[model samples]
Target: MLKFLPGILLLQVITVVLVLIAPTELSGWGWLRLVIPVGIVGVLTAAWFSSMAAHHNKDEISRLQECHAKEREALRVNAERAKHRVIKQAHQETIQEVRRTSTQANIKVGMAFAGAAGIGGLLLLTQFITLGLLMLTTAGGALGGYVLRIRQEKAKMELLPKTKTKPRLINASPTTK
Candidate 1:
């Protein structure tokens, strides 16, 4: 209101001067007086409303910005959680695969031992002592060879360094005859 005081006073003075200078026949002091006050009030009201609107718009923009920030944070957190979940699931799958492979290996070893024992028992029951001893010796030798081979292979695996590179094919494309 104070900022507009000088301009309002100047406007009032101009209107009064115009009314006084006008010809008697054209002049209408009554109309001018009423219009002048209404115009000033209208201008002041417009200024006040516009200022209020600007303040409200600023508040609304800040609120929207805050909401957007919170949404972005939530999205970031969710993404991290999803990544962790995928890693955890993959780890669990790897553990399960290892367990399954170990169980299969154990079953195969048990079957081999059981087969050797059954054959040896059958030979002994038929009164073939020499044949039974030979069979048991052969089975033991074979088992020992298998264990040695497995140990050698395990040692080889341990000696080799782990690599992430893909193996190159010896013959990637077929040659034309």
Candidate 2:
């Protein structure tokens, strides 16, 4: 009430004092004198509060939009990090597969070499050199297969992107013997 008292007093002062000072043709219109100003003040106050509510609502909407944008940015960052982790894990698995393939190719190469030596020696002792060519051909085929497998593993390794290894933080205890 105190906050509005000045405005109310000003309205009343205008209605009574302004008409009395001018003594206009409408001054004798007794009730119209007070009613007109009261109605005008009421309309002006209503428009003021309506515009104020609109401004407040606009500010609130902008604040909410900012909050939502921040949340979306956070989600995007987390999703990007998750994708990086998945790619790293895939690379690790690919490296492991390449290692396993290399090991298998080496074993195959050794077996082919050993088989060739054994068959060649056996055929030499029996004096069947012409027929021994078939055994040599078989060993050659195994060696070719080994070479192909090794090449495949090398190609896979080259296809992978290079990643730096981060130093791991190991859990160490001083009491350990």
Candidate 3:
């Protein structure tokens, strides 16, 4: 809109100069007739071009806005996917740690049972029947407790949220107790 200010000013200046310099015979109405029609045409032409420019700008703005919206949506999806991947990795790490600790526990328990059996056999051979039975009973109790603990851990793992889209695990870390 402001771009045509200089042209409009120039036209007004030219009309004033023509009206001032025209011969006295034609001074009154001659310049008025020429200037009025020319001014009208100039104004109409400026308006038409300004309207076209405004329409083009409107379309460009719409296109840019749509492009930005699509980009925003893509960024949101990527962020969600990244969040899921991080959660899944955490879960995998927790499971692997549990397996490693459980393996070690199993080895220790097996050793305990084996030691108990060997000592119980020696005690029995030495005619210590009562002591041998007690030792075996304690080992049995230890085995039972280990089995129960494993069952509890499996149950805990199964308690994780079922939704694959947004899985959540509470108490995912192994408890010492």
Candidate 4:
């Protein structure tokens, strides 16, 4: 069936040329003029379908495969970036949380130190030097706690992986962090 294309095309081309070379007027074979074109079209249609039956594929399979591959690649890249966005957003939130915690810790340390200074003053008023020194040591401990919290936050930041800058276009590759 597939071997009939060249023969069918040649026959069609010859018929068309013969018709072209003939007279323009169709007074003699009026019905034949219409039937000839219609018959040729039917024959070509039958030949194309029969060829497909023998060959298993008549359409452009390679072109369709290329289209599907491109679609798959785009979808794959989009899925990766979607996952990256979630992780990147979480990392930024964690950094912001660390900064907030550090600020609060420092504020609390300042208030605690102020209270300790008041206690020291009261002790001094009563002439209790040893107890006043104890209050000062307690204040030092509060400062130490503040320093530890900040240091811990810094360590946490260090442990976290940084996110890289994303490209403006989907086709562009991501830049390193």
Question: Which candidate leads in TM-score?
Answer: 3
- Worst lDDT run of 10 residues, candidate 4, spans 163-172
lDDT of each: 0.74, 0.73, 0.79, 0.76
- Order of quality (lDDT): 3, 4, 1, 2
Per-residue CA lDDT of candidate 3, range 13-98, in tens?
Answer: 77677667665675767767767766776687678667777987999999999999888877776777788898889988998998
lDDT of 4 by residue, 101-155 (tens): 8688778878879889789878978999899979878888877887888789779
- Candidate 3 displacement at residue 111 in angstroms: 2.5
Candidate 1 regions exceeding 4 Å error are 1-29, 116-177
Q: lDDT tens string, model 1, 83-144?
A: 76777789779979976996798689868976986798799999988888888888888788
User: For model 2, how does the per-residue alpha-carbon lDDT over 64-111 read when each residue is reduced to its tens digit?
Assistant: 999998888777667766777787899789979977987886887797
The true-structure Cα RMSD of candidate 4 reads 8.7
Worst 10 residues of 3 by lDDT: 163-172
Best by lDDT: 3
Clashing pairs in 4: none
The best-first sequence of candidates by TM-score reads: 3, 2, 4, 1
Candidate 3 stretches with Cα past 4 Å from truth are: 1-29, 125-127, 148-177
TM-score of 4: 0.56
